[model samples]
Target: MTRRRPPVTPDQIIAHRRAHVISQAAKVGVSAACRAAGVSRTAYYRWVKAAARYGSAALVPKRRRPPVMPTAMSAQEVSAILAVAVAHPTLGARQLLRHLAKHDVHRSASGVQKVLVRHQLGRRAQRLAALASLTAADTGQLTDAAMAGPFGFCQAASVAGQNVSMDTFYVGKLKGVGTIWQFTAVDVATRWAIVALIVGDKTAAGAARFLDHVRAEFGRLGVPVTGVLTDNGPEFVGRDFTSHLGDLGIAHHRIPPRSPNHNAVCERFQGTLLHEFYRPFFYRARIDRIADLQTGLAAAITDYNHHRPNNGAYMAGRTPRQLLNEKRPAQSAA
Candidate 1:
């Protein structure tokens, strides 16, 4: 086998050539020194050229220059753009550009969007709203469940004491009338409901009849109700309706005007009843039959309260009857 060449070191090569140039000053030139050191004459000439152009430091390797800086924007300008993005997450780049232009930012929409995407500032508007809503509450009080959603209420007692939710729906066309009114009263705690099919009139007498029906149903269920909650409809807000509830020693709580979420439970249940029972039957019969409608309503309510599963955190996948049993075990245990 041929002899292996020794590993070359930069310092060794440089020093060896430098010493050869000094010691063999008369016998060797730069080309001869390179040949003896096992380096190419061309490489030696290149080094000499570089040294002449950039001094002895050219023989040492230069550090890499940092990458070019991207188009620079001031921190305040960036923050302003970010704030706009936070406010309107779903806004398109064009819209954002327009908004920025209105505020005198004077940047192209695509350019601003490029900045937003690079900074990961793009998102949907609702997500921002949800994030904003998550700030800590005042003091150390926990969030009230009733304030949360349809099933969010303060306590189990709030349901048992007197809190009620009421709503009205149409029972299709009645004889000589376009539609009949079906008023409902639901106990927030138990999910127990009392519904009445009344004539088209929304008079004090009709309100009284609904109250009487609710009282009878409450007695049958053996649950004492403390409050009656209804919308601000003229019939519900009248003096006659207030006096009737007062006479029964029950409090009346009117939901805030135009806030359907306040009476969400009753409203949701009414929709369910209309879909599952009333609509199908009315469509088939072509006319409302009071007796048949009443039977259907009773059956639907029974299915809803005892058999249907409540999809609320308070009920925790339990049926309304199971929840009622848990709340007032004495009656439910029987």
Candidate 2:
């Protein structure tokens, strides 16, 4: 059974407060004053405390419970750890943990690994790690651009809510739907992924719409978006696209041309989605295929977010949603 909530309005609250104040001035007992105001003694006292601290606006209903993140570290601490990961993209989880400890940020290697898994930093780490051990002799004949990727190693998102990596993947051309575009966004700190499928051309309008979808999704999840990482695709750099992002106060960071590694998280997910999602439908009959594709994509995404087992060393049996829920940061204390 669902319990009905009472409507709280300014007028109603003002009247309640007035009654409680009048009853108190009349030398009424605390319980009696609360009862006259249709509230409890505890609530009345809390309001009194609020009034003493924050003035009349304190009468507005306050959130009863604060947010919680599983770890003991603060947002700043998490950010610092991520900053290191972003800076040294080649570092393994154990190496990262040792690096952090060197700077007085003492966290177990498992903790650092969890952060890496949640951000899908494994691929970039592996790529850069291989390159890091290469000798000058090994690269002497190679061009600079051929050796180091464009934009080099980018920083990881410091805060769970701070940055999201966005990229567009081209699905095969459907008979009726023409070209299919999957615009994917993954939170740089959490592995939470969202994919928006489009049947039409991937235009500025489409990119803007996708950005709006990302904003709404993150908003519902209580994440504060700071920046979007994209490649120099026309869909992302067009006037409508950047303009919409600007309106929402979201910063746009475009990776260097020819450098998909800069947005490695989103890029890797595209491959995963292709294998885990689109491949199964490749041989299906074309009759009413778009609907089937839509349903299949939706189901695949649902499982990916909630049910899919992550095999990363740090993630083990957990899913993206589970990791995100566990590591979701709390609102800072007042």
Candidate 3:
């Protein structure tokens, strides 16, 4: 059997009863009406005065007033919490509290969380976005003419070739060529990208070939590709790909299932290639040959890595090529 909820009389009914009591008082007397209505004389008088001043609508009961808590966070504390949260977007409230304390801003983890929630930054994603927005503003990327991207605060690579993210893009079928796949590899630190086009099917062998291309490209930069991160796709996880990485002495890192953001650096570069290069190039020029497309892709990659100013985190208004070149002397191009 379902349990019954406590009956709550509607506000209209209460207002009507109060109105009737006032009317009854007009007919008989105030004290008699109060006794009949089972209400105190003081309450009856107060309601009468309220109805007269604010109309009969005022006869309805009001909810209990909220009390102000003295222990609530101060404005400065809230500011500190928010600032710390945006600085370390990936950190939780407890982790952020320590940072806040470093700035001499003391607050409990729960208090910091409350501030975060109030500002609609309770989630780590929201915090990341806040950091991105802040970075965009700092880098002058956010303007009336152009707005910065969502991943503007992308994680910076500490060292070149330490971590390389790889992914496959299915570049639709051509009339002459059956199907084409574009394999992409991006250095996490410098955002240096390498694209290889494969006609027909994408296999583990193709992926391995792409790895070799990445090695050759980064090899020119004088940095050995140490680790390769990719999604848990068949081509990437297959024995052939694994064996190739082993042969080259490169570590293979696969992101967890259903988490595309883990390999987001590769994903972002692929998106940039699609929107900035392929889409625009295809719109103006017709390309039926894979070699022609590869030629265009190579030029686009060169422009992207060398010319285009990256506003992402740690870039400091510099291009990926600039960072890579700087790393050449130190031998840590990340």
Candidate 4:
């Protein structure tokens, strides 16, 4: 076995080196001693002067102090901002400034945000995490909602196929094919995604047809979609789409007006699809027909579901297909 050595502190090393230099200077001269010690003559003289003026302890090196910023918030101000932010984790910086004013802690929204950034609480998700930790400490239990994603909207699907979030994305118009729209559906629990590219306008009839495709695809896998979540777009609220969902016995859920975060699962998936597949693929691949784009999209979605690792609340670090397989048996039992 290798013998363990005791740790040496920086101050100890500095003191030892300085004592060697002093002994060398007493034997030889200051110039020669500084050359042997590999230290500047000015530094050696400055150390000697400090030791003589103060005590021998002054010769030992001290850790440099952190520079204080003139515009930095005081401890009390930081505490006040954190308290208000934790109390209302959903509030934006401007809204938080109003609450801070009531407590006699005056600060601009940007200043408060700077303080939050300094303390690693800049994002609302991080603040919500801090609030969850406080609640857990006080109650010894944390709810599922508290552990959910940034908006807590994805928590609506507690099990696989419980809820499916659907949305429409506008892919750039093709020269020959005209306008193109991507109909995207993601399982809120497993994040299993299906996408279809339409060559024309995204009408109610088209959306309803996409819903049929989604149900049929999941049905083939022995998973029944229980609820459909969508934004308040005309395509979703129209009679054709509503009547289709009603006939299929699937409950239709609409997000609040102008609140896209309530449908964040679909929103984030669309962003990923755009960045990972569409952007790069369109940049290189020539699109002569809508059929070619649809085929490419289907292949990308397959890779996403089967191979790509997802870091979602439900997926952890597994692929959507793996998560779906793990949850399908339990869902059938329920």
Q: Which candidate is the best by TM-score?
A: 3
Q: Over 4 Å off in model 3, which ranges? A: 1-53, 56-156, 329-334
How accurate locally, in lDDT, is each candidate? 0.66, 0.71, 0.80, 0.83
N/CA/C clash count, model 4? 0
Clashes of 1: 6
lDDT of 3 by residue, 121-142 (tens): 8988777677666654465233
lDDT accuracy of residue 191 in candidate 3: 79
Q: How far is candidate 4 from the true structure (C-alpha RMSD, Å)?
A: 11.4
Model 3 compared with the native: what TM-score? 0.60
What is the overall TM-score of model 2 with all chains considered together? 0.53
Among these predicted structures, which one has the highest lDDT?
A: 4
Which residue pairs in model 2 clash with each other?
86-156
Sorted by lDDT (best first), the order is 4, 3, 2, 1
- The Cα RMSD of model 2 versus the native structure comes to 22.4
| Residue pairs with clashing backbones, model 1 | 145-152, 145-153, 146-152, 146-153, 162-226, 162-227
Model 4 residue runs over 4 Å out of place are: 1-151, 329-334
Return the candidate ranking by TM-score, descending. Answer: 3, 4, 2, 1
lDDT tens readout by residue for model 1, 84-114: 7656667876787767765667677777777
Q: Least accurate stretch of 10 residues (summed lDDT) in model 2?
A: 133-142
Provide the TM-score for each candidate, comma-separated. 0.52, 0.53, 0.60, 0.56
